[model samples]
Target: MNRNALIAAMIMALLGGFLLFAYLKKFEEEASGGAPVKLLVARKHIEPGTVVTDDMLATRVVPAAYVETRAVREAEKARVVGLRLATPVQAQQTLLWTDLAITADDKRDLSSLVQPGMRAVGVRAANDDKSFALMRPGDRVDVIATFPIEGSTQRQSIVLLQNVMVLAVGLDTTAIDTSKQGGSPSSQDLLLNLSLTLPEAQLLSLAAEKGRISVALRNPDDVRITDSLADLNSNLLTDSKTRKTVQDFRKTPTGPVKLPSAAGAQ
Candidate 1:
């Protein structure tokens, strides 16, 4: 072979080797970077405030580059199982930390929802009050107490607390637990959790212990403070002709004077 042809052949061989080495390096980098990572995704449409369950989640293999920092991994399914969702997540969408209603540490205790310096007091629901069954977290309510008067057999219903924020409806802060009954009699009882001030909590605790406690649902937009001192009495509905006359007796100079009692005598 000619010297020039031999030299060109050697150069072409070296060039080809260099291109092969570059191609191999690029393939190696792609192989190293394109690994699949497992991410937790919602198996079905999960509404906000719905409790996450194992069946509602599925593992999805996605490119590592697409995995977000806040994305929950398949291994974290156990931790997310009982947690609530703060926002709705579509089916097959990746579950993220921000999508959760509460943090992992705060899921067990809903005190985080209570305003700072407020108390979370749970009052027992009256079996007859079906409104408790419809309540949800973040709802507003009026706490009503029904118990007999100190010396009378007549039951009196009073508004013990007003415009109270409902921290939870049932034991599980996320779900409506109609099965959990808990009144004075087990069958008639359900728990209604509320957020109140210290004094309001004390009042509610006493009311719950002394009488049957019931909650009246309020409109979320209706935060109007009710200063009503009126107490409801069943006698108001009874026929006036058959109702017994109540008199307010007071001491007087001549003798004890009597006057007609108010509609509801406190």
Candidate 2:
């Protein structure tokens, strides 16, 4: 072969080798799961309607191919931290955009929803009461105050306000919950915002500070107000066994025992 032709053949062989090497490397990357991406996941099981915070979140790098299209990424972590989840996410599970509560996208002022004669206030829903976190916007609730009555040995449980509208639950404004998210309750308080009159707000403030407040969920269609409602006290305990237990406890008052939540923590 001619000298020029021999050099040309050598050059072509080197070029082909380079291209083949590059192709193999690319194929291997794809087979292994492609490039790593920073995906945001729940550090612990997160309950529905619970507001997310930085401590509850974690970032992991996984193969790009394994990630869900709707999964929240590290860049979006800031936005998700302060928002509520519409559904529950398991520990180490990927957080998706679809997991966000309806209120997560709400940027409007809550003041706009408050009428001139009404006020909006937030109440902390007990972690034990899953119903309060499940309440939705526009749902009716009856606020009940349980506190020690003046000059009485027993506490009085009376209805403070009836047929009050639930403005928001955990700031979600959705009464719905995801069955999948059921698990140990989040450490974060399930915040509930209610719409109330000025007088009712004052009453709630006073009652909430004085004693524990509980909300009774009401049927939206049933707006009939009950009159002459009697307050509940120790006298109402008709069950002999239960009454004995209460009386025994009251005599040497030890608060209720703390136990693990119904939904066991993972």
Candidate 3:
């Protein structure tokens, strides 16, 4: 064949092969629902009310035909990053918009925000204690507990929990709504929702029932956990130097406060 003729024949053969491949691919996809589409999925089991973060999410390849509108698409994955989850999701399960804690759909339940394997604990503070009022969601604080000791009539103040995160202030995790500005916090609602492990929650519950617990506000950037802490017991409460020591201690890590000795108490 001439050069022009040969080139035209080769082009036609190549075009035919490409068309056949495309047809087969389309048929396969049709049989299997549709083309693979990107979807957002849980990398691990995520608890409800827990703030969604980058690490907890993963992309999944799902058939386009099977994807629901509620499921988050890969194109919109960034939308969920800073939002909280409204419902618990198992590992590898698809994430839906309904699962997110947004607007009126957001559940008032604190359990949704508790991290997987962790527990939500509400630690009561004294009404006049202004520390908890200053604590917002995501702020970390150390918990201090004051209780009467067996040997002493004076109450002992000891550091209970360290570097703990505040989940919510009186069931309102975000902050005081702009609409609620005119309203004042009621005396009966002194509960602060705190994220804690099972054991920590148990300890805190007992402390709230038996003694008084207080929130020691923490700086968002500071994460240092003090290795050595001197309990502020009878001797320190009476000592004049303790005033300075207590002031210094207030700036440290914050957490759920409970009496460590509660289990053995009479």
Candidate 4:
């Protein structure tokens, strides 16, 4: 045949072969029923412990081969509708069953925030005691317990918990909202939530019930655990010279007044 005719035939043969391959592939996919599956994905950045709502979720159709093993199926929408996210999910990311905290109540509960073997215990404090409302979530603090000394009538203070994380300060856990200056939380409703082991939770509860509890904010990097239980008496003064000088001044009266003798006689 002619050179032009031969090239035209080859092009026509290639086009026919491409069409046949496409038709066969379509038939195979239909026979196997391998269509794209819909996966539930986060429409926005969902933070951990957030309740899953309709507005925050969307669906994406992924090929059967590309579908993730643990991706939440669109058919299971009801199961995850009210559940909480155990970890943060980025926008347009496929939601996984493992990422959610499934509970019968289908609510975002505070217990979910507690560690596996730990408990979340809340302790009430006077507003003036806990940084005057400056404390917020994730702040580390040392829980101080003040109660009457066993034998003496004076009150002594001791650190009950050191380098403990403050889960929630007051009812709000995210931040201290001061938008409405006149609607600040009352001192009576102030609370400090803590994550502690079972034994530690019990000890903290007992201390709160029996004595006064206060929190001393600490530097985040200060993880030093000291066994030193210093008493809150005058003797606790670091400088002995200053303590002695104050003692000598208190003993002598500035004005001329009749002083009682150290002996029984007045």
Candidate 5:
């Protein structure tokens, strides 16, 4: 071979070796950087329809090259639904190109006890002097019936329903806007809808036949924990001091005896 050609071949081999060495070094630097990213989770388990929040991010592990402040920020906004609780996640859960937050309001009324097949009556009454001033929907109440029983000398006030839900207070269950109505509605008129059981409906009907029925507001903390009739009667009896008073009054009568006057008087 010519001397010039041999020299040129040796130079080309040297340049190729240097380029290969540089490429291998660069690959090694990337491999040794850090642990692969592991996606962090918010809660151990979540139900369906739950919105993802910022607190549910996994930040400890990430790809060495992909780990950047911008990437982390973008990932914080990502939301995923299939994340079962306690499942290990990866960088795939992160949001890379979207700006959004997952959220929803799930408030519900816990007072309504009306169920299918249950017999209920709709009752209405006034709260304040104005019909609009009274009770609101979702409020709990005790229904009292004042009636005279057959052969009884006096009237009795009995509780017909306990922990009853007030489904509405006026003509509307929500609210009535007088301005939208073009004129003010009567203030003294109010209406209420209530749920009742079969026996309760019978009792209410019988009592209503004899006298007036009214509703007594109950404490908000009072909850219907039991449906035991005996317990209810016991509670009602305990609350009534009138029965004891009446028994005592009957035992002692105020009058004068006239047996001796019949024998001695002219």
Candidate 6:
């Protein structure tokens, strides 16, 4: 055979062999389940600003065709910044979705009143008492007030309120460090400005006029609802039943029951 023809035949043979090998490889891949099965990126709990790492991918026990490349790619770009994650991901509780807005004023306000999920009560602080230094905004306390009648020695120290929120201390709306005092802007000496309801405020004012007020710390678990003196007093004085009883008592004859004189009886 001619040299050129032999060379051409050899090239053609090599080409044919290459094509056969490619075909066989393709057939083997088809018969043996194609490429390796991979994980699907779950859509739930995908937080904003969260970096998608290999660990974030969700794998399945059985190889399935439902896993899409697009889903995986999308998950790779997911991030979390502020919002809460609905579900916890593997080894990760989804990142925040948005920025949390927490400011000094917010913290101060929250420290005072009933918080988002908390219940609050009101109590009175004494103007002349020195024990206010012992109380704070978050401190739990039982309020006691004593009222003395005019021109009389009788005095009653009753529990005016309980489980009340200490909103502020000595006009400091925010939290204060009571431990240290006497510095620049000299801190007020533990004068607490408590948050009280309208009725509690009235009671505080009334008690301040007649007697002294004091506070007692309570157990963390001891939350009691005390009677509102204003409401009780108003009801006792104005209620129809109470009014009728008072009226009947007043209408009863004041005439003294006559006992037989000793001489008459003999």
lDDT of 4 by residue, 50-164 (tens): 9999888899997664553346789878878887887799999999765776543442345544545667788887646535367755677888887876777667677798877
Q: Using alpha carbons, what is the TM-score of model 1?
A: 0.46
Residue pairs clashing in model 1 are 182-189, 182-190, 183-189
How far off is residue 79 in model 1, in Å? 13
Best by TM-score: 3
Give the TM-score of each candidate.
0.46, 0.47, 0.52, 0.46, 0.37, 0.37
Each candidate's lDDT (Cα)?
0.71, 0.73, 0.73, 0.71, 0.49, 0.49
Candidate achieving higher lDDT, 1 or 3? 3
Give the CA lDDT, 0 to 100, for residue 258 in model 5: 29
Residues 147-187, model 5: lDDT tens digits: 66457555566666777766545443332222344454454
Cα lDDT tens digits, model 3, 1-266, are: 59999999999999999999999999999999887889999999999889999999899998876664346778877777999886799999999766777663443456656645677777776767645555556678888787898766877777788878777777565533323455556543466777788998888777777688887777666767876677777776567887777676655444323436877687
Pairs with backbone N, CA or C atoms under 3 Å apart (clashes), candidate 4? none
Where does model 4 exceed 4 Å of error?
Answer: 1-108, 127-132, 176-183, 187-189, 234-266
Name every residue pair that clashes in candidate 2. Answer: 135-175, 136-174, 136-175
lDDT of 1 by residue, 17-72 (tens): 99999999878757765557899999899999999998999999976645544467
- In the range 160-259, model 6's lDDT, one tens digit per residue, is 7776666555544433353475443224544555556667777777877667777887654455554443212333454798667645643444212344
The candidate, 1 or 2, that scores higher on lDDT is 2
Model 2, stretches more than 4 Å misplaced?
1-103, 174-189, 238-266
